[model samples]
Structure formats: structure tokens, C-alpha cells
Target: MRKIIIGVMGPGERAREDHVRNAFELGRLIAQEGWVTLTGGRNAGVMEAASLGAKEAGGLTLGILPTRDRNLISVAVDIPIITDMGSARNNINALTSDLIIACGLGTGTASEVALALKANTPVILLTENEEGKRFFKALKPKLVFIAKEPSEAIQMAKEILSP
Candidate 1:
């Protein structure tokens, strides 16, 4: 059976405290459920936090890097796929994951969510950004869901991915 991959998307450098906390918990919970946690692979913000939690919880983590700089890769990343494609790597992140949980609102995260929606992939927006929620939901009513919390995001992932 293929392991489910849940991509954690959020701001890299300017991550909010809530976003970091939520991403960590989400990664931990995702690990507990025996799922793979995927992130941007950077050593900052949600990518680092989520990978750290997942790695600590004994989960497999895959990081899709937007840069060729190996030093930027998260220490917790078990597998890092270096992509020199820059922000365009968001396409890979959005398309590769079985599900995506947007941990916060950011330009990068928004693009990932949009790419996911465009591909008809399921996304759970785990942010309090009402405007973002409204915009995304307006784009894909069924494919886009909102979760106010990390645990709820996990539950929504299950509901979205289950056969």
C-alpha cells in the first residue's frame, strides 16, 4: 500500500507562532497515523517545524526544496529532493501530496493551495485567514475545506483521502 503524503504548506521565514505550533502538531499526528509528512524542506518556518515533529515521532519525511542550496534543507528531513525550480517547485509540492494542509497564509502557501485546487487535489486550509478561506473555497467548493485547528485538519485529511 502506498503511504499517504500530507504536505504542510506555510510561510518559510515569517511564520506565525500559531502556524509553527500547528504544523508541528500536524506533523506529529500525521506520523502517529503512519502517514508521510511533506514540506518545502527549508530550515525555517513551517517546513522545519513540521519535519522536526514528524522526525521526532518516527515518521518518514520528504522535503521538496525550492533551491539547490543543500544547507537550507531541514535537518529533520529524511529525504530531500533538491529542485532548482525556485517557487515553481510549489507545483511539485501541490501535485505530489495525497493531501495538503496549509498551516498559514503566505504568498508561497497560497500558490501551493491554488496549484492543488487547479489539479483537483484536496486541501485543508488550517489558517484563520477568512479572506483566504473565502477565496480558495470560492475557487473549488468541494476540493477546498477549512480547518481551524491542526487536529481538525488531520481529521479532514482522513475524510478527504479515505476510500
Candidate 2:
């Protein structure tokens, strides 16, 4: 089986309590589904939470970092792919992913979303509010699925990966 590369996009700071828990659950589910996780290599927020979850589940976690600094890499990341492309590397990361999960996000996350859309990779957004609804709606017919919880997001990703 071609390994399904799951991209997780979110901020670099510590996320809200709910988001942090959800991100961890999402990573666990992704590992359970036999998918590899790809994310930015940072120590806080959804990236760190998901990486840790995947690690605990015995899954491979790949970090696509913007610099060569080993100290900047997250502890949960098992493989670090260093690139000097800075923000431009976001597109490369998106291309490497077969599916993307967007948690609570920032500008960098937004860039990944755009790149995923451009690459025609399926994306699942985890958000419950009107803003998320509006954002998904605005991207009409792009195969961008939205879920209120981690399970739903993983389910959507699995469905997308089905042959």
C-alpha cells in the first residue's frame, strides 16, 4: 500500500485546551488508520500534540522544517526534512500529503490549505463555528470536508483514501 501522508496544519503556539486534545485524538486515529503524518516541526500547538500522539501510536511522523536547525525540530518528529525555502516550503509539504487536516490555524496554516486545494488533495477542516462553515462554503465543490470532531475528520480522510 502506498503510505497515506496526512498533513496537519495549525499554529506554532499552544492551542486552546479543546483543540489540543482534538489534535492528539486526530493523530491517534490517523496512526490507527495506518497513515503517516506530515507537519511543520515546532514544539507547540497542534503540531506538537499530533506528533506526540502519532509517536505514542507507533506511527511515523515526518517534519518538513524551514531551517536546518536541529534544535527547532519537535521531539515527536522521527524524520525531519529540512528545506531552506521558508514559507514556500509549505507548498512542498502540501504536495507531499495525500490528505490534509486543518486544526485551529494561523497564516501558515492558511497557506497550506491553499496549496492543498491547488494540488487537488482532499482536506478536512475541524471547526464548529460559523466562520469555519463560511470558509468551507466559500470553497465550494473543492472536496473540502468539514467536521466538528476528530473522529469525523479521520473518517472523511479514510473515505477519501478508499480505492
Please estimate how well model 2 matches the true structure, expressed as its whole-model Cα lDDT.
Answer: 0.82
Cα-based TM-score, every candidate: 0.98, 0.92
Model 1, position 11, has a per-residue lDDT of 92
lDDT of 2 by residue, 69-133 (tens): 78878999998889967888899878999988988656787788878888888778875546755
| TM-score of model number 1 | 0.98
* Candidate with best TM-score: 1
Give the lowest summed-lDDT range of ten residues in model 2.
Answer: 128-137
Question: Distance from true position, residue 101, model 1, in Å?
Answer: 0.4
lDDT of 1: 0.93
> Under the 3 Å rule for N, CA and C atoms, how many clashes does model 1 have?
0
Clashes of each: 0, 0
